[model samples]
Target chain A: MSQATLNRLADAGFSGWTTVTGRTLAAYQAAVVRIGVALTFGGFLLREWPHRRVLYGDLSPWSGDLARQMLASNHAFTVLAWSDGRWWFEGVYAAAIAVSVLMLLGWRTRATSLLFMVLVLSLQNRAVLVGDGGDNVIHLMAIYLAFTRCGQVWSLDARAARRGTRRTGDPVGVVVWAALGLALAYCQLSGFASLGMLDFGLYSWGTFFWLCWLLAGLRGLLARRAPEGEGLALLDALATLVHNAAMLVIAAEVCFIYATAGWYKIQGSLWQGGTALWYPLHLHYFEPWPGLADGLSGSSTLVTAITYGTVIAQVGFPFLVFNRRIKNVMLTLMIAEHLGIAIVLGLPFFSLAMITADAVFLPTGFLARLGQGVARGVARIAATPVVRQTIMRAPRTPERDPEAVSVIR
Target chain B: MADEPDEATSPEPIPPLAETPDLPDEERRWSLPSLLVLYLTAVAVAVAVVYHLGTVFLSIAPANPVSQRHATAINAHVLPEFEQNWQLFAPNPLQQNIAVQARVQTVDSTGHRLDSPWIDLTARDVAAIRGNPLPSHVNQNQLRRAWDYYTAWHDQQTEKSTGFGGPLSEEYLKRIGLQRIGRDWEGMAVIQIQFRSATTDVTGPSWTGAPATTSPSYRQLPWWPANDDDYRGLGVS
Candidate 1:
């Protein structure tokens, strides 16, 4: 192309580019909000008023042994440091959970968010066998939230007495934006990795489905801030189209997972009549409930129905999840599937992690409302003057000029 | 704004712009150091997450865990089944089959020349002849198969060679029944033999434009043994 033509094209592209930048920045802002909510909620869930342990304590000895083995294998990494007979790991886990709870509560929000990120990374690094995809997603988001203005609103840090005294513009938002970009890159890599596993074709399908859900979730968030314009509108329109395309790719991946798994299971003779359900129960490693397998075996019809149902549910999940009613039913079936696997197959940790990711498909409004409720409860306790004063007096930027506040925010 | 005279040109070098911005109270923009720190921290966290999760996901499915355990259990249950199923079927059989026949001259504890009667044993029954029911300690099944394998080759040598006297000298024969043999130098009590099969010339009907012949003929060749020395050479001292 001629230089004149190239210049013209560049000029045209610049306008579209700025709009994209603006939209992306807005998306980053929204992502920060979502991440903040997730962290705060997760943190609160960690803290126990009565000092009771819930999730980690429930992990079986096999799971613990597996974690120890993983830690031992990767000793050079030293990602997980366990000393004093479980004191270090347990202490870190508890502290992380507590910080996560505090982050959710929005009390000393930034500090807690930072600590939570550190602790989570430490725990995750120490034990490769204990985590799942949800842990990965949450950890990534938590790191982003730690550096963002996630505590700007609906937080004890925000509602302090000296609220307007603090400088609003912090590069914490930029850090979060970078983190989100990294997350996108990670998900893309994860998707490609899943596709690489050709031998376990059906398992790849599951991974593909997961990647699709991740893309769809991200797309849904991005769609809210799509730009408005005439020529710019067309660019925005193209972005939406791309987002839709991403969603379709994810959908296709999900379909592949279910279809391949269904086919593989059905092709196997033992899986058709429900006799295979007892196989897991018979295995010493996986038998969580021993007699239950015998009971399931006795009812061949029930077992067969479950087998057929699992195949149908898995195959239909991508399509069915689109429909609100069917989605709920599918969600229920997925839960049941995981629960059944946990009891019969003894994969409690895996089942729980998978179940948690499935929760992402629940109505965003429902989660938002839950977040609001938690925020309200936190606000009530944190309304005291002493707590307010402590947060307000925590830190202040050197610039006290009120005029500069509106320049950034 | 232009009428307000340029600050530097108008009068007494209107105090440096840096000094005029209300000392420490001036608007403090986000600094590069702060941004760098936050970015580094975020990147570090990202790395940790990826490293931890990647290792976990990759390590979930191992190929040999169940197979290793099951092989041990199966071995315990059916040892004889492995013994009964041995066979010597290679695509192309070796030309020079070697055998070792040895007689150990030693008393069983009383220092007498061990003149035990010659025991007739089939090559396939060497494991039984040696009175060692179990296979060797090596994990590879091929090693166990090798024992039955080379013994069959030795049997083929004894059967093919009519006059074994040239290679099977008295000194060599004495070594066979007591000491070690084979490429691996495995020590075992057994006879060693070595010989080469004679090459045969084919003479048949001319179905494919070739001349027909009346008979097939064979020629003898010197034997090249597989093992270093014949089994008869090694005596149990």
Candidate 2:
């Protein structure tokens, strides 16, 4: 490259860094997406816990060999496939459930998010034909989350960071280092769980994040010990730039999905004529409550309006996203629409997954305020003697940190 | 209105988001290496994003010109992890309750051949879902996908006017019937499987003073020879 070209490229890269670092300030929105996805999975795991074997066990309606064939077709992997033995499947299943709970709690999020992806992909892949739009959304969202600092708020990791203890780094670093060491060692000892993935790149997710956390702890210590904390503008710039761009891409991805779906619907005679929802309403598979669907389907005008309104809201959504007022209105409309789909179509998981993705588009301030209001309400309710006796009767343990009581909504 | 307190009359307006966020205890000056890190992160993210967007575009309309241009590449890279189709109930809503049913070929008391009782799988699924607060997701998928998989064969095979109800459909229905019946369910000598759909025409509503007798109309398929592939990979048999 010429000298001038080199200088220009360098300058542009620097400028890009500056622009992104400044703009991608808040991690709050990312945190909401993480929590929402995590919570949805938490519910799913809980609901499916007793029937986990039925879903993915050797004796599932979808047989194990068939599942393996399906997974192989999709280039997906699960520890269950490594060994035909029942113990391996059970161990792997337990690990997935544990990772899900951790994701929900937002502890060690950087590691858990990737594991969450693995679990979603593996389980969904295991029963590919039995999956839906919601499962696919979750699959994609889990992958997207690994690029984000989703545990920056409303998470146990965030609470730890929030503590920001002024005590000498020795104790904190030692404790954190010990915890990480134990976790890595535990992973090594958990041979059966990691058996299928031992030879693969999936095992690195734990080691990679552990190293990161360890390095961060050491960095925190050194920064406090010395006056200057690395003072690396490049690192900060890079972090900010990645966060901003990734978030923008995720948002755009969602918008594209909606626009494309809407576009497809628009081409259909049913959608254009506003009788699209009528068939689904009458379908036995979608009818959770047949009476409710039948009662609602009785009205022609309402059905047509809903059908047309759905198409309009979805088609015009990409344009609305740039304008806060329109976006807010659209978000409400979309959430309501998804809720209807959930109830009328017997697709709670799909609706919830879509709604979780939509929550990211909502302003962080709005969500935070809502969280705060809920927190306050809970506090008020807890103050009552009867409520306190019933709920707060359990013996309390000392908090990890006094300042860690933000209780991110 | 004039007597309203000053605080009530004029509250402070919130600042626009373009202004720097007033985050608590988050202030830190930008350093050069930090900036470099930010740039590098952006670069990495940008590459991944391009790939993600590419796959998403391909998945949306795989037959479109742009998608077809890169079809070979997409099949290799994107089709594995990101292969998706959004056509749930699209183009037109599925205007029918496609109840997959089966009838076992049996011997009558009069030494004559006969098709046994019709077992409605769709009805079983509906019954399973009705009272349960947390219905198994498979209940929603099992019969539907079976029917869809059966129907998809036609679109892939020769042109068919009606959905999966032609000459070669028996093998497909037998596979689905075997899936439902499995090795258990009394292990009866089930010979064949067929399907019926109760189609509803919403374009013409009962409320419009049309024939109130527009109840669920059942269109049953002819029984296929109970194929052995139904028992092939199920592992139960």
Clashes of each: 27, 20
Best by lDDT: 2
lDDT of 2 by residue, A1-409 (tens): 9999999999997555456664444466787778778777767767777766656665455666555555554556455664566676677677777887888777766556766777776677766666778878887788778666676556666455545322344353455456656654564566643423433353344455555555445444444454244432233334445667677767877887788788888889989877777778866677778788878878889888998998898789889988998899999999998988878777887888899889878886787777678769988988754455456663354533323233321
Q: Per-residue lDDT for A1-409 in model 1, tens only?
A: 9999999999887554333222222222222343444543353334322221112221111123333444343331222332323444456556666666666555544345555555555554443223333344454444444433344334444444124322222233334434544643563465532213211344232353344334333433332243111222232223322322322322333344344445455555556544445344443223335466567655657756776676677657767878988888788888788777655654443455445445535554454556568768878756644454345452355533344344334
Considering the two chains of model 1, state its CAPRI-style docking category: incorrect
With candidate 2 superimposed using the best TM-score fit, by how many Å does residue A318's alpha carbon deviate from the native? Answer: 0.8
In model 2 chain B, which range of ten residues has the least summed lDDT?
B1-10
Worst 10 residues of 1 chain A by lDDT: A53-62
RMSD of 2: 9.6
Q: Residue by residue across B1-237, what tens digits does model 2's lDDT show?
A: 000011111123223233222121135554676546544665667887787677677768627887778777777666556666666566666765566666666434464566657777778888877745456665887557756755655543333424423322344345546666663334345555555655544434545574533566665655555545556654546
lDDT (CA) per prediction: 0.38, 0.63
Worst 10 residues of 1 chain B by lDDT: B1-10
Off by over 4 Å in 1: A1-78, A81-91, A103-121, A129-269, A339-349, A365-409, B1-237
lDDT string for model 1 (B110-163, tens) is: 433233232321122233212232211111111222223333334343433223
